[model samples]
Target: MTTVGNRSITLEDFYQILFKDNAIEISPAAQKRVSDCFAFLLDFAKEKLIYGINTGFGPMAQYRIDEHEQAQLQYNLIRSHCAGQGKPIDTVYVKALMVARLNTFLRGKSGVHPDVVALLTAFINRDIFPVIFEHGSVGASGDLVQLAHLALGLIGEGKMWHEGRQVPASEVLAAHNLTPLSVHLREGLALMNGTSVMTGIGVVNLIHSRNLLNWSLVSSSLLSEIVESYDDHYSAELNEAKHHPGQQQVAAQMRAILQDSDLVRKRHEHLYDKKVTADVLEDKVQEFYSIRCVPQILGPVYDTIASATTVVMHEINSVSDNPIIDKDKGSVYHGGNFHGDYVSLEMDKLKIAITKLSMLAERQLNFLLNNKLNNKLPPFVNLGRLGFNLGMQGAQFVATSTVAENQTFSFPMYVHSIPNNNDNQDIVSMGTNSAQITSKVIENTYQVLAVQLLTTIQAVDYLGFEDRLSSVSREVYQQLRALVPVFTEDGIMTEKILKIKEFIQAEHVQLPASVVGQPAAVAATELVAS
Candidate 1:
């Protein structure tokens, strides 16, 4: 269990320790540390007139502030920067963002009052997450706008949705018997001058993109087996000849996935004219380039995602807060630690991988939908031509449309930057926008995958008991068969598609017992089986 009150803070703590136990409170030790640091910062400001403490910030740094106006300066900073503009994220994610920001502040290096920590701790304990928009963060200068929106509600200056109604933060805090902080210190800068939102979302996106890549491989293997694709695309010699690490890895995985498929040729027999295979007589045959090049199309996306995950994990564990207080030197030097270029680039790559996978799944669905393309399979993988078996027309439509939407969303937001913050923030990273874009790309992938799942199952039934699917795909087929049986008529496919979506994201695939050693979960299971 992760408790903010009873633990020492560390990078490791944020990555693995703080989850499941969301109850956050300042322990006596943490309170003392925060109090001591806040006192030091105030002393420093009084003596030195630090850049943003006793004076105005950014372009107005030269303007001096009176003692009575210091609190107002910080308040003004929060009020002016609440510029986020988009749909709110999942409550779970909002909670995660809160946790990330709180944990970073608890390091006692951000110069915020202890009472401010207590206020955030209360929000975490009570599950009162502030609504934050996806847009408005430039990913440079610490997600300023989004963090400002988050802080506004904390100061009772903005509205927050609670118990199904938008209400003032003051009322919610009063009702819950929690008090807002009396002294406005560096809490606004502390909250805003960090990469918590990008880091939080990036870490989660890393995990998801990795799993989605695996599922893409799993899905690709299934389609190849269903269409009886050639072994040429995955040959070790072919990939080794060029040896791009990502491409080689993907080809290897494809080979492993189709290892025991009887349909894979022992050798290439003849010309493929889209309608036939081996240029010989066979009802069941090798499919066209769309099906044959499954590995070629999907393998690179998988590799790119894996590489991106590695980069993102390192980034999440990083200390990305500005003005990092040095205990030994007793100085707080402001720097661009929160600049989002690194994160945004990786997220852009994530967008590409996600969009490509959705496109691959859509292509597979197209192959299964066309009888001429699907060899001798029934129209739309229908088990009966006389209206007895329902085709996967609805599911196919969803996959196609979902892919189209994903393509549109993949437009790079990071490339679009503008000067703002009185020109102090001239060039922006838009890292948060990159993260938001990738999130939608991930959702589009789910929709596309759901459709492919429906088509694969339908195609299996179309083949009937006469043809045995590959060992890997057959196991996957059985799992779906248990939930969604062969559609005897044109019934609702939405429910079935939804079910498959849940199963993949939940990692419900099974591992073979015959494997020498492997984890029991489908993550290891599907990889080994494939």
Candidate 2:
């Protein structure tokens, strides 16, 4: 069981809550803090006028709502803001959004009742996910529209995904022997006003992006071995001079992945050995940029993902709602923590990094297919009759097109905000859109990397070095080859490419222990085992 509000939550905790069905228990201290905060709000409500407690919302805030009708006002706010449109997001994301929102309330500043927090926890524990739409959030003033739909599910008014089916929340609650919640005071506003959607989606994207980075490292290492490239470029002396942590880390992992390889030649061995001629030695002296600059190109991507992880973890644990209740000071503070600019900008950077990674993979695929650049490999990587078989030629075209599409998706969504909310929100951060596009780019990159790995395995088989690959590279090649056979003659490759993509995204391919973080590596293994 996972305990909320006891300490800061990590990305692994969120993953457990979303995927592992880990039950959540709000810490007793957190319950007391929430109770104390709510009690203070009730006491202060008699003597003062508070925003969202007795006043209207947004542009209507100028109009004063009567104290008796405040409850009605809060209820109406949730129903009216359930104006989200487009397709429903995955249930895992909805559950993640709930977890993010609940963590904010756990800070004891949102002024929500302890029961509200408990109910949210129950939703997660029971796998009751709210049906949240993909659109309708400006990512400022919170993910108002989508979160409002979540708020409706909490009150048993909207649709929910339960037992693998979308059903009315009321029916699901009834079946589970649960009662719908009654909003009191500012509870509805507390629920709907936050950056939960953006943060939740960003967290999920960050997790997948980390996995993708690990796989890209594996793919790049495999490419190095397949091309029989020089390992001097990844020498420790060279990377240490660069003084980049990510660059140094990549160099170490690449060296480990390519350890004990018969194919990858040392500079001195190729230069001094009498068996090799000057022409062959010159060709082995330097590789193309794609193979030569693996660390230089992918190193910054590693650092960017690390930076994005920091920003996302902070956002998940932050109190992003308005009108924060301070029990100690006995006052309410209205601030703009709901703005998602931090997450939006970080996600934008992540997409660009992922796109660059995909471009590198596509270039490597091109190198492997072209006979001249491939170090005397057969044309089109075909092992059969030259003109009769096309091998992975069609698949290479698909990979190139996907990389181009990813480039287009790399355009920053943060720069294209439009004013909304009756012009009250003049500049908005399209954070949800940014996260969504980041996910799409990652999906496309997976296919690109899949094409690269598939082509590498085919090339390895054609070169008759399948049994002589580096230990780690052999494990990765065998794992992929078990799922997808080498293409001797090209037929319909769509299914084979997708199967490889599934293996990549599923993280079934084992990477060098040094490349993947300890926690993530364990998680991936556990996920595959389960």
* Candidate closest to the true structure, highest lDDT: 2
lDDT per residue, candidate 2, 55-79, as tens digits? 8887778788887788899889999
Name model 2 segments beyond 4 Å from true: 272-282, 507-514, 517-530
- Model 1: runs farther than 4 Å from truth? 2-40, 106-108, 115-122, 156-167, 171-177, 182-184, 230-232, 235-242, 251-265, 268-287, 384-390, 465-472, 507-530
Local error of candidate 1 at 156, Å?
Answer: 5.0
Counted clashes in each candidate structure: 2, 0
lDDT of 1 by residue, 83-113 (tens): 7777876655566666667766666677787
Tell me each candidate's RMSD, in Å, in order: 5.1, 3.1
Predict model 2's lDDT versus the native. 0.84
How well does each candidate superpose onto the true structure, as a TM-score? 0.82, 0.95
